[model samples]
Every structure is written in C-alpha cells, then in structure tokens.
Target: MARFEVPDGSTVQAYRFALDPTPVQARALASHAGAARFAHNHMLTLVKAVMDQRAAERSYGIAEEELTPALGWSLPALRKVWNQRKTFCAPWWPENSKEAYNTGLDSLARGLDAWSRSRHGLRSGKAVGFGRFKTARARRSVRFTTGTIRVEPDRHHVTLPRVGTIRTHESTRKLARRIEAGTARILSATVNQDSSGRWYCSFQTLVTAKTRPAHAPRSSQRIVGVDVGVRADGLLVVATPDGCEVARVPAPRSLSAAQRRLRMLQRRAARQHGPYDPVAQTKRRPSKRWRATQARIGKTHAHAAAVRRDVLHKATTSLAQQHQVVVVETLNVAGMRAKGGVRKRGLNRALADAAVAEVRRLLEYKSRWYGSELVAADRFYPSSKTCSGCGRRKPNLTLADRVFECDGCGVRIDRDLNAAINLARLGEPADAGEQGPAGSGPVAGRGATRETDPAKAGDAAGDEASTPHHHQVDQTGTASPQGEAA
Candidate 1:
C-alpha cells in the first residue's frame, strides 16, 4: 500500500481590502509596529546580555545552560517584556489583540534562532546578526501578518484584529463570489504597501479550486531550453528539436519609454541633490522646485516597475502553461559586468532590475498548479559554447556571434534560439551524470565535472563586495549569474 500524504488544499477563499485609515487608525498601526519592534529588540538585548554573561562565567566554570531558566532563547521571556510594555502603548491598541504581542515575540525568537545558528558556525554560508532597531525611515516599510482577519462587506470595510476597519482602494477580488457561495473562510489578511505607497491586502483564504486535467497527452510532453541575453530579439532564445529561434513577443513600449524618462529624472534628481551620505543618514530635501521633480522621479520608477511586472507575469504564465519541462542556462552576470566595456553598466543594471529569482519562484509554484517541471541548470553549465545539434563545444564563442554555427555538425541557427533548444533538450536530467530524455543527447559538462582545475571550472563567483549578483531567473528560467539578462 502506497501511503500518500493528504494535501492540505484549502476549501476557503480570501478577500483583500485596502485600508483607508483615519488619523487615529494610522496612529494605532504605528503603535502596533512599535510594539512588534520593541519585542524584537528586547529579545535581542537579552540574548546578547546572556551570551556576554556566559563568556564572563567561563572563568568560574559555569556552563551556559545554568542560565537557561533565566535568560534562555525562549519566547516566554520576550512575551514577559511585551506584557510589561503593553500598558505604555497607545489607547487605541485593541484589547482583543493581546495575543499579538506574544505572536510578535514568537516570530522574533524564531528569527533570532536562525540568526544565532547562522552566526555561530552551526549553519553554512555567511554569519547572521541581529538587525538594527527600525528607525522612522525604515518604519515606512509595510507590515504583514497571517492572523487577525475580519471582513464586513455591508459597510465596505475590513477590520484586522490589531488595526480595525480599514479602507480599501478596490473591492476584494473573488471574495464576493466565494462569500455568496459560502465556501470562503478568511483566516488572516496581510496588509502591504508597495514602493509607490499603494496599499494592498492579501487575504489568506481557504477556497476550493477545480483541478483541470492536462489537455496534452503525457507522452507528447515537449521540454525546452532557454538562454536569455540582452539582444534586439525579445532577449530570449528558445531551442527545440527541429531548430532554434528567438521567442517572439511584442516589445514593451511603455517600459522602454519609462526607462528613458527615468534617466532624465535621475539626472535632474542628481542635479538637485548632491551625492548620498551614509553617515548623515538623511536625504537632503532640495528646494521647493525639486519636490515636483522628486514626485515625477518616484512616479517614473514605479511606472517602470509596474510595466516590467505585467510583462513578466504574461511571459511566465505562458511558459508555465505550454510546457511539461523547462531548462535554462545560468550565465555569469557578475563576470560579464567586471569585464565592463561600453554599455556594460546599463546591461548590468537591467539584469538586476529584471528580478530573475522572483520569476523562477513564481514559476516553481505555478508549475505545481499545471503539473509542469522547471529545471535550473548548474551555474557552470556552458549552454552557449556547446552546439545543440552536435555534441562538440565551441571554445571561442563571442557575444557578437548572433548565430550559433557548429563546426562539427555544420548546423547554423539563431544563437539565442539554439541555446533555448539546448536547454529544452536537457529536459528531466541536468545533473552531470544523468542521461537526458531519450534522444536529447548528453547533458553539458559530462566528464569535466571535476572542480580541481580552476580553468575548467567555467566561471568563478565574484567577491561578494564587488558582485552585483541577483538571484532572479527571467520568465524563461534562464539565469544570468549576477541577475541581469535584458
């Protein structure tokens, strides 16, 4: 008997309501944020104090665990601090949300535990440390929680447990349908603000979704390989078994225009205000004339982001729906930038802004819904140099080579398309030793997987300080190592 784990698919739907907070309501939110911050800092202080005490006690032969009951990394102690400070909170602090303080403490403790482990040699990678207390500037950032939700459609209001009935910019999406059907149950509503200062609410809803069966037969699954680059043709090169060509999509006019406008605004902004001062910790507010320029500057950046987001969503959704498998090469974005020549900075910046990791993340979850698979080839996999048609590698490939010509097989095709086809051919197996789908041919770097030789290692990850690395994958799943492709 194959015992399968039951999936926890929700039978309820969530509704998001943008909050229109009164002055009083805004103050209450500030208070809640403060309480949360206070709890976090207080817990951190205790941790540091206890650790310091333990270090001093080592001379007396006292173990660190001796202070476990008094100054341990427990949430209860942090809650005690919250309980004591709760009295000093603003009058609007909801009594019903008394548990919120504890919730905040619990979250802080978990963060601390992760930080401690990362910092104290228990975890791999970099050491983590306590974040500094949130200042007024940082407090401008939005807060979200997966608890305390209430909705009243009659009054066109939604009340969070901590912060009461808030206004929304727009009515909840799909909430009315779910409510009418009586299948929706709201668990928590998380409120967030974007960079442009637009508020959004994400309702944690429990609703049923009709799982659609695949229209395409399982045996006919077509996998693809995508290689992304900054080029005139859609920045995406896709390769299939027949041949390779660029993925054709309408160029985003609005985004390109916004980028141009943003450059003008940036220049204006620079002229208005001098260089940034890290030590000063305050952005110099320019003259009254500059304020208008500032607003235009903010709007320009926000518009560009919105345009990029729309394009990315469309691209990712299409890819997720059409294919059963996807594979993409990881290009070294950092090294490309360091070997900077003309226009390298612009290319680097675009790649960073594309948010490749975010796209991959969206695809991973979206794939589950469609039963498709997405594979991210190792960063060292040389998709561009290797000929898709023939198994031979092209050692002296250049960026100017728009078309991929195989010396061994005499196959010529659009460079980007060939790379995409190669990635698609990789299919289910991307690891060094595994065989690719039947006739797709061997995966890249078959025998030269060893890392002992520096030259054969493909490219090295640049220093953290110098690397403008972004972990984002483009909609096509091709990753430029430092995050920019186009």
Candidate 2:
C-alpha cells in the first residue's frame, strides 16, 4: 500500500512561482499595487481627520451626545464610502480592476481592527500603533480573490485576471497535476515583487492532500535529538540517547561568502546618481548604471537567502522523516543577538548564518507532514550542563568548555553530543522500560523533577498551578528549599 492516503478533509496551501513578464505587464501590475496603496492611505487619512475633529469638539465643551460620530473602519463600511468618493478621489479608477482597490481597503480594515484590539489589551505582543501610509518604492504587492486564475495545461504559463497569461520561470506541474485531478481549487492569487526585483505569483488553493499514519514503523522508531549551534566546523549536530552521532551538517555561510561582491556592487551604486541626494536637499532620478548595480546587489542577496533556505529545508525534512521523535531546544535567538560587542557581533553573524529559528519553524510543519513527533525542551533545561551518562548537574560550566566531564561518575563526552543525548532522553515516555541502572535517576522528566523539592513539596502543592515560580536545583541535584511565592 502507498504510505500516504488522502482523507475526506481538505487543507489550504499556497503555490508560489516566479513570473517572467514583459515591461508593459510589469507596469500594469505595479499600477494595480499602487492603486491599492492609494486607497489604503486615503481611508486612513479620513479616519484620522474624523478622530481629530471629534477630539476638538469635545475640548470646546460640546455636549457628549453632540460630538461628531466616529468613522467606521470595517471593510464593508470602508468600501461603501470609497465607492461614493472613488470617482472624485481616483480619476483613473477605470484603468485597474476592482480587486486592486478592494485589496487596499481590506488591508486597512484588518490593520485598524488590529490596532483597536491591541489598545484594548486583547492582542498579544507589543502595542500596535496606527497604520501608516505605504510608500511606493518600498515593496509592491496586490491580491486578487474574485479574478480568474488558472494554470495552463502545459504548466508553462499562468492566466491571471487583467494580467492575462504570463510565462513562469519554472514548471508548475505539481499544481497543474492536482488541479487536473480535481483535488485542488485555487481560491486567491497574490502578485508581488520581492526585494530582488523579481516578480512572483502565489495561489492559495484548497487541496486534498494524503496523510500517513502518525506513528513511525516499529523497527524504525528511533528517537533523535538535534542540537543547533555554530561550531568551528559545522552548523548542526544530531545524536541519539546513547550518545551516538546521527548526522552533522556543515553550514554553507552563504551570506558571508557573498558579502565581498555585494559590498563592491553597493559602493559602485552609491557613486552614481540615486533617487535622493541628502547633502543637496533635493531629489534626483537614479542613473541607469545605479539601477543596474542595485539590481545586481539585490540578486546577490536573494541568491544567498535561497541557498540558506534550501539547506534548512533539506536538513529538517531528513530529520523529520528518519526519526519518530525529534527533540530540540527552545532558543531565544533575539536575546542572544542583543548583547552587542565586537566579539558578540561575530557571534551574531554566526547565529544568523545557522538560522536556528528558521530550522525550528521548518521542522514543526515538516514533522507533521512526515508523521513525526517534535519535542521542545524547556528554555532553561540546562541540557548542556547536565551529564547524560550519570544525570549529574554542573552549576558552573562555561562556554569555553567544549567537552562535558562528569565529576559524579568521571564520564567525559563532547559537549554538543552530551546535550543532544540529554535532549533525546526527554522524548522517552515515562512508562518506557528502565533507562540503565536504578541509580541513573529519572530520564523522561528529569528537568521537571529537579523542580520538586521534598522539603517544600507540600507547600508548593497547595499553591495555584498558574502562579509563577522559579525552578532552581542545588548541588545535590534536588530542588532548592526556597521558592518564590507568587
């Protein structure tokens, strides 16, 4: 039987492909994107004006009931207002499809809703400010939901509403085959230009994809732990619970390798007439040389990004397919990169080259696709400091120590290998057979077990589970007597 089977349910996925458009088509696409931006900015301006008017009225001692009514930011309301005023505001509205204008209004509506929810403390993350106007030269993109979008039978051309048929840089056989099989339907298409100046189209499709059994085959049910770091030679290390190495993939360092050429291109571009001249306090059009140099620089950066993404995808897919349970650390990449110094800058570059966060993201979705379970160890689990063989904890291990030596049992091992083994042990089930001898301590929940101090276990049990507290382990490998009460 085939490993995968299509179920009754459907899933939404995007198929993105590069486009090769003529100059005229590129201009038309840019116009549509610009129209969307104009509509968004116009609505935002009106909303802000109404808000200011209401505030001024209230300050002038106007009665609360007599204040100007607040402007609506809903999509339907915005569209209605735009329809009544678009003829006067945008005299060239007839030149573009209605989908272009709708795209802008929809974007504004969502942004307004997000801002309102954030101010009321209903949204997560940092407080969102009011939506800003979109600049023309930043990035251009537009979505078409009501348009006719389809892939040609030859899989070489795609037909989009208004844009007509355009050639694809690569074959769209995968999406074409699915559409022909009647298992997929394109719902929306978004056309966008990347920083590299390359145009692309993305189709959001409702697809019926086959899924396999969630469990790995019994004979291949091996668990592997992944330790992602920038070592002197490699980028990642995969090891099993027995401290056996599975794989070590080297980092390509694409960005670093392309930096010299990019620097030269940027220098040449800077010497030419650009869009703005700060010293002259005047705007100047970019010369042909400048534009060409800029494009070269953009392409170089894009190539580097593609290389990094390719490596990450291959590594994650292989690990997810081969292992039943994949374990990794929950890293705070932003925090690590924030400590700034000359040496820290180099470390930050290395971290960016490794792309640990992207690896984790790909691993998450790929694991689901390949029928593997992904486990994330706690951020403060101390996997590196704890010895995998003896389960002993070291309180003062330094970054300079590449080898982990256990004082309790005199067992020494490579630092990354030890950490990987410790992480792999976390994926083991609690009811699984014993891990080595009886004095080996707990394996599955070893990290959590260190938080339960026998001296204060009774008091801690009475505390609310939601209350926050720090988990500290002492030299004796037991939780500390003192706990922070919340």
Candidate 3:
C-alpha cells in the first residue's frame, strides 16, 4: 500500500499558478465559505453542549460516551443534522451543493479531533478549543485544498461540485495538453479573495516529470555541509572543503517596515469616531477610501511573503539539484527563542524569513526526486563550538565569535564554514564503534521502537538516528561534516 512519507531524495517539484475568477464564481465562493463557517460554528455549539451534558452527568456519576449520539461525531451523522437544520441556514447560503455543507463539517471534524487530542496532551502545537462564532475578517483565514480538478464548461462559466456555473476571469492554461499527456491530476480547488477584493480559483495539480539523477556523484561525493544563518538571503551557503563560501544572498527586505505601516493603518481605523455604541457589538463599514487604503496595506504584507517564499524555493531547488548528499546542523530554534520572548515577534518573523523549516522540508522531497541523500546532524553536535579540522570542542565559544579559533589544532575558520565542513564529514558511511553520543543516548517511553501511528512513527524514526563518526548526526535533526573540510 502506498503511504505518505517526508520527501527524502530530490523528487518533488511544485508550481503555484495565479487564477482569475468571474463574478458568478465569486458569489459561489462566498457562499461556500460562509456555509463552511456556519457548519463549523454549529458543530462547535453541538460539541460544547455535549461536553456540558457530560460534565453534568459526571457530577451525577454518569459516563461521557452516552452523549456521543447527540454530538454527531461522524460525517454522515453530522450531515443529517445539517439537512434537518437547513431551513435555519443563512438566506444567502447556496442551496444547490451539498459539498459546501460537507466541507464545513469536514473542517469542524478536524478541529474537534485536534481539540480533543490536545486537551489530553496527544497532539502537538498550541492547544485548540471550540472557536467563537466567526465574523468576516476572522473567518477568512481557512485552508482549503486546491489541486488540478477539472470543471464542466458551460455557456458563461463552469460547474463545480459545491459551486456551480462559476465564470472564470481567465481561460484555463494548457490543460488539454496536460490531459493528453496523462501527467496531471486534479487535487482540489480553493476560492480565495485577495486584498484587492478580487476572487481567484487556485487549482492544485500533480505534475509528473522524468527527473534524471545527477551525472555521477562529484568524486567529492564527500558530504557538503551547509550553515544556515539570518545574514544572507536568509542562508549563509558554506562549503565543506577548505571551508569555501559559495552563496551569500542578502536578507530579503524585512517585514518590520511593513509591520509599522500596518500598525499605522490599524491605529487610523481605531480613531474613526462615529455614533459608535460599545454596548452593541456592531460597526459601520468603513468608507470606500478607507477600505482602499486598508487593502493597500494588506497587499504590501502579501508581497513581502511572496518574495520570501519565492527566494526560499529557488535556493532550495538549487541546492537539491547540485549535491548528492547534504549536511546541516540541527538548531534548537525553540530553545534559543525562549530566553528572548520580548523580542519574539521580530525574532520569529526573522526565523520565518530565513525559511529554515521550509528549506529542510523542501530538501527532503527534492533529494528524493534527485536520488540524493540528506544527512542531519544532532542538535548537540556542537558544530559551532568544535573545530572543523580537529575534534576539539570549544566550550568557551560565544555567539560573538563569528570566526572559530581552535586551541587544539591552532586552526582558524569562519564559524559558519567550519560548521558546514563538519556537517559534510558526517555524510560518509560509519562503523559501529563510531556511533557517536546521540546513538548511545538513553532511551525512554517507546524509544526508537515500532509505532503504529504515522505521527509517532516520525518521532520514533527521529529517536533512532545515530550520530555519524566523521560528522556527527545529532538529535536536532542536522548532520555535521567531519574530517578535513570537504
């Protein structure tokens, strides 16, 4: 059976295409989105009621599962509830498509499951709770699948499942060719409204390419170490051998400037004095001019995000295409940020700008696509403190020391380059004796053992990673290179 796994070698390529939607299509989208919100809110209410009933039952020595039927945990059961309550749905809600209603319940189901799991400490990320009834701005933030799904062409538009006879602002691309070649498969489609108030349909497609492996691994198939930093295009590209510097893309323009602008917009919005009554939770829509300005501010933020994503994609693609094996140091971003919570907004934004997670994720898929290997070193490998040439760990190393000075080998090198070289050294196959400290670390819980769940499997696999002899692979999920640089 086919299963989902993180991309390992370079094999995956993604393309994001812009879309154009017509007026009818826009209306359909609005309905679906609204219906989705309605379903989510309704389900939340149902769940909360069940919880309250269960709590009351427990007070009287009763059980929880007895309330499941009223809660409607299953999709079909929830749909039945929605069908019965259709009359109370918003007037503007679309009547034709059941899919819109289904979509809402789908989201609610996932949200419910997440909230349930998190409450029991069985899920990652921040704990979620039943959301408050949503309004326009807050409700707009939802993720929907948008892949290569074909639409039935009609006189003035195309028919979609939940959204019917929607017009397109632009014609479809070489879809006919894609269909003929049989390489494209429609995933799902999403209707998004831009800050410009323009609607677009984004279709996600699975495009297949006959990717060829790189011509023979560089005789220096020796691992290449990478040092990720916030200085260059969010990355400080260093080579393993001789601590060579390869790429130095400047930091993309920062969001700080845009953030200031957004703050100004928000402040202005807050200052609008009207016949506003605090007791009544209502507000008059802003003037057209004000709305225009707000949109412009939103557009600015969007542009910055686009630039960051584009740059990351290009850098990751380039790295994946060239190397047989990649080595990178595992960084403890969470731990590093813990001490600086006050400046976390800026730091977190910077981290995102660096796109460290995206790079790692992309490398996994790209490496699989290219039949290359990615080696991650342990978090405690001390890539920064240790000398690249010698196994001397500099306990006194400080962040201020951009250049590494090794007391043992009397060698000096750029800190990033040294780390990269160390990471590259770890790419070589290792013997049992050189398993390193990480491999020999203590095990607890299900430590590196078999797991039935996918999420747990990932954690288990991570625990099983052993430190390499040359460049140590550490617990932080990065690989350090060892030996003489390159």
Q: Largest lDDT belongs to which candidate?
A: 2
Best by TM-score: 2
For model 1, where is the 10-residue window of minimal lDDT? 456-465
User: lDDT for model 1, on a 0 to 1 scale?
Assistant: 0.54
lDDT by residue for model 1 (395-464), tens: 8998779788999889887777766666666664533335454334643553211111111110111100
- 259-303 per-residue lDDT for model 2 (tens digits): 899889988887898888989989888898888888899899889
Question: Per-residue error at 141 for model 1, in Å?
Answer: 5.7
Q: How big is the positional error of residue 351 in model 2, measured in Å on the Cα after superposition?
A: 2.7
Instruction: Give per-residue lDDT, candidate 2, residue 396.
Output: 90
Reference-based lDDT, residue 168, model 1: 65
Between 1 and 2, whose TM-score is larger? 2
Pairs in clash, predicted candidate 2: none
Error of 3 at 100 (Å): 2.2
The digit string of per-residue lDDT tens for model 3 on 311-356 reads 7767766676676667666677766666766656666767766666
Ranking by TM-score: 2, 3, 1
The local distance difference test score of each candidate is 0.54, 0.73, 0.54
Candidate 1 residue spans exceeding 4 A from truth: 1-27, 57-70, 74-77, 88-107, 120-127, 139-148, 151-157, 179-184, 210-221, 244-246, 250-296, 329-344, 428-443, 446-486
- When sorted by lDDT, best at the front, the candidate numbers are 2, 3, 1
